[model samples]
Target: MAPQSNRVVELRIPSELGYEKIAREAVATVAHRLNFTKEKVEDIKTAISEACTNAIRYGSGSDARMKVVVILTADEDKLDILIKDPGASGAPPIDIDIPDIDGMVEGKRRLGGMGLYIIRELVDEAGFVEAADDDEGNQFRMVIYRVEDTKTESSPEASASGADNGGSP
Candidate 1:
């Protein structure tokens, strides 16, 4: 369970502020080093941003301040990110299931629910956790895994799951 390398960075996101850029920079820093392609890196950033954006929405109200925590970690052959957010009402639990794309139409649909769908598609591995909030509110945990090769994934510990996707692999 030891990472080859890891970095934990925390930032305060105002309800009126956007946290996507924070996610992009943090993921890019370690992903580039882990040999993730430019496109793959972008996908990973998108996933991370989606989750953070939701945390800002559901966790904290516009006037309240929230926290964005990002951890960049890797082994010799893989990369994993652990991002945690404490919600506005404190951490509301996150549902891992992808949102229905059909019902969430652009013209008549919701704008905010696409993050969970996109996050699953972009990452090789994804996991979410809702924690008990004392003063911080709800907490959500997102883990994205990036392994170097398909061969390595055949082992007992495969991080990526295809349950919520649309045959992307």
Candidate 2:
């Protein structure tokens, strides 16, 4: 529930080691502007790191020089991210293998699929799309909803969607 007040920043990072720094800076600045809690800032930056890492590791030309685009938008109640990457070179399409959405493993996480997992855990709504041949490489979008609740409560609509309700699963 953003109060119709927020800040947004867009940065273009070339496929280089310094891309991570750009992402880090973007998160830091936006967090400061939004007055995000320390934990929220950490979550945002971490998610940004995963996104940039994927783009750099995957999107690039044979020349090993490419570009990554990162967009960060934050408000009093939400944070939205859009990341675009050409895609991993010479890489096969691999289904992202993640543990059940509600599961987590303490300190034994691998880097590959961990990004999406972490993003899901930290954010309220997260989604990714591989853009068409006509669009950018891989376009991923993640949204984090602000929370004021210490106890998790299910929305009626959400609960209904999961139940047979008056029909079937």
Candidate with top lDDT is 2
Report the CA-based lDDT of candidate 1 relative to the real structure.
Answer: 0.55
Residue 92 error, candidate 1, Å:
4.2
True-vs-predicted CA distance for residue 62, candidate 2, Å: 9.5
lDDT of 1 by residue, 1-169 (tens): 3345554455555544465577677777777776777887887778767766665666555444546565655556556665555544543443444455566675565645656656665665564543444534443444444554542433323333532221111
What does candidate 2's lDDT look like per residue over 1-169, in tens digits? 2336656778878877656678877776776666667877787788777667766765554223677888888776767787776655533233334444344344454324565555544544555655666874666676665663421233433322221211100
Q: Name every residue pair that clashes in candidate 2.
A: 58-87, 58-88
RMSD values, in order shown:
6.0, 7.8
Q: Estimate each model's TM-score.
A: 0.66, 0.66
Poorly placed runs, candidate 2 (over 4 Å): 1-6, 61-64, 88-96, 99-112, 130-134, 148-169
Model 1 lDDT-worst window of ten = 160-169
Cα error, residue 136 of model 1, in Å, equals 5.2
